[model samples]
Structure formats: structure tokens, C-alpha cells
Target: MNLYKEPLSRFLISYNLCSQRSAKNFVKNNEVVVNGNSIKDAAFLVDTENDTVIVGGKILPQVKHKYIMLNKPEGVVCSTVSDSHKTVYDLLKGNFNETELYKLKCVGRLDNNTSGLLLLSTNGTFVNQLTSPENEVEKTYFVKLRDSITDKKSYVLKAEKGIEIPPENKSPAFISKSAFIKWLSDESLEITITEGKFHEIRRIFSALGNYVVKLKRLKMGDFILDETLNEGEFKFL
Candidate 1:
């Protein structure tokens, strides 16, 4: 009935208590309890924020998922575990407990050198929806080139069709999918790509004989970088 309300059977599955079929059976067999009362209807709605769910004498935890928008800074790794480098998680330690912090995952990772709109979330489904290539989520980047490209239109045409990136450092040669390019100036441009291939944007420019001096992502899908967030700052959505 409300955003926080979910069917008892589905809530059981969301908590990883049981499979969908088993959840139905658990409710039907009077084995599941909600708010101290036996719940026989699998579809019976429970307010996830207020109702308590119990199964097999064990209370199921209602995990609260959080979405964070981080203006990641350079030199910070996008991993939860990194022995030699400062990870993005290091910036988030005080914000969440150890368990919840570790559960957070980067939706689409930004390399140590690349910085801009980065998404972190505890919801695996939300992460998958945004990062999945099947969804074709568009990622926009603000690029600064090492040198001005005189024949920008030609290269832009090539990129629009597709650019072939050579294999390097164990990464196989790949052809980028079609992309949209808008030149901001002689030495700068913004590119929008759907696929988040490894070093894809840099490689695309490299393949075109231009080197990228700096790269910052400005947007991903419907989410744009919050201009107010300074480097390394994050806020919950």
C-alpha cells in the first residue's frame, strides 16, 4: 500500500530467509510471524520500517539500502579492499558502521586518476540496474586533451561510427560502441557513452591519436554530479 510496505512472502525473500516458493509455504503453514502475530497470507503487507518479521525462531533483519553520490577525488581507489592505496571506503568510515559500509558497492567505478560523479549503494539491484550494459545507461565525461585537435570534426565522425582501441596491458583490443561528442573548445570536449568499458574514454581518444590530459565524468544516466559536493564529499540520496 505504501513505499515501505511489502508483501510478507516477498520480504522473506528480500531478507534472504527463503526462496520464493518456500516463503509462500512458510506463510501458508503458519511458520512465519509478523509483529508477534502469525501471518498465514503470503501477500499480507507488512510495513518494513515498523513491522518485525520472524521465521524459524530467528528474526529477519530489514536491511535499509542507502544511495550515495560521491564527488570522488583523484588518487583514491574505488575498491573496498586495497592494501597499497587509499580506497573510497576510507572516506566513508565515519558515515556508516563496519557492516553497512562494507556492504556498499560502487555502481560504476572511477579509476584513481578519473574523478566525478560516482555512485555508491547498498542495494545490489539498484547497482545492477544502473551499471548493466543491457540497460545502455549513458555516461557523460568532460575531457581535456593534451593538445588541440585541429580536425576535430573528422575524429568526432569516427567516434560516432565507432573507434577501435588496441590491446594494452593485458586488455584485449576492443571497438567502442557509437558515442556522441560535443566540442566545448579546440582542446576540450564532452563525450557521452553508454558502455563503461575499462579505460574506454581514454582509449577512444588514444585510438584517435589524441592523448587525454584530464577526464572528469559529469553525468551517468539520469543522475548528474552535484556541483556543490567538493572533492571526496558524498551525500545520501
Candidate 2:
């Protein structure tokens, strides 16, 4: 069973009860109490449900759970708050009550210009589960390249460094393993990655001496972008 788990140091820091050093000091000074008993170890584990935490005489609010899936369209920002253009929340206008939106936040971020499946939730535990590197959620993408690809280059892309380009212009920023590329015509390709990084899909092709003409995320975790959910549409998971 997945019990409420968090490092004491992180718990204190997350609740703003104290800075890391201050938290350590609090432990050392016996100023923090867990389950009505003063504890001295900063790394101590506490049962989140059963333990009572008191720091500076204030109790931390218990976090609730939430989850959402958005078909983020190009030009929409995935941020919780934004200053320019429309945000992902803008698309959900009037769909959910204030309480729901208030608790809602993006699980993972997509660049403002990228389009694809975006996951959001207030469920910190589930969010952590999905985002953890150990989980290895596979994300797929449909990419368009500015130039045509040759069979030789395709082999190179699958084997050697492929079409090498500068770091900035590539699709995926880093390639842990040689990428799997399938040619769809000469300029379009489908790729898959178990690990997602900032602008990763775009950077990888750029590094291969090709610029990404269009990019769309096709899947995340086990979910795929349903053809029925048009751009700017979303569905409950």
C-alpha cells in the first residue's frame, strides 16, 4: 500500500514552516513535534494521516487529490498562470466550477508552441507517481522535418549520431539511446521516447541537421491523443 510518505525535511520545507537550515535547526533544537512527541531527525518519516505535525504553532493544510487531461493546442500556454495569450485554463472556462479549477494544476508542462496531450491534476501523490523517473512513461510524437530524409540518413539516425546538428536547433535536447525513427514519406517521421525533456523531440531532429517543421505529441504514459478530441478539446481520464 502507498502510505502518505514524505521526508521530514521536505515536508517542513514544502509547508513553508522553515527553510532547510531552519528545519534542521528546529530538529536539533527539539522545536518540532510529530505525533505529539518531539523528534530530532530532519529526515524522519511520519505517517501523514496519523501523525500530528506542529511547527511554529501552525498546522499544514492537508492536500486533496485532482486529475485532468487537456488536448493542448498550439499557442496555448500550459502554465497555471500566464500574462500573455490564452492559458490551458482558458479553454476550460465555464466547464468546471471555481473549486475544481482552483485545485487544478498541470501535471507536466508543454511548451507554449507545442501541441499535444497534457495532463493536469491536484493529486500530488498521483502526479508524483507519473512524473517519477522510475515510472518511465512513454511519450510519442509526430514530427515534420523541413527537409527530405534519405535512406542513408535514416540508417544514420537509427544507428550512429545520425544527422548531427547543434544542440540548440535539435528536437530532443539529449538522446539517451539512439532514437527510433520511422519514415512517413520523406519529410515526416514518428518517434517515441520513454523520457521527456524540454523540447526534446524538436531538438533531436535539429541535432540531425534537420529543423522540425511541425511537432505534435501523440501520447503520454498509456494515453494517446484521440482523433475525436479536436484541438482545444479535453476528456476526463
| Candidate achieving the largest lDDT | 1
lDDT of 1 by residue, 109-178 (tens): 9998998999997765668778889888999999999988888889789999998899878789988999
Global lDDT of each candidate: 0.86, 0.70
Error of 1 at 13 (Å): 3.9
Once fitted onto the true fold, the runs of candidate 1 whose alpha carbons sit more than 4 angstroms away are 1-11, 14-16, 19-63
How large is the C-alpha RMSD of every model relative to the true structure? Answer: 4.9, 5.5
Relative to the unseen true structure, what is the C-alpha lDDT of residue 5 in candidate 2, on a scale of 0 to 100? Answer: 54
lDDT of 1: 0.86
Across 9-48, the per-residue lDDT of candidate 2 in tens digits comes to 7777777767987887867875777777777888787655
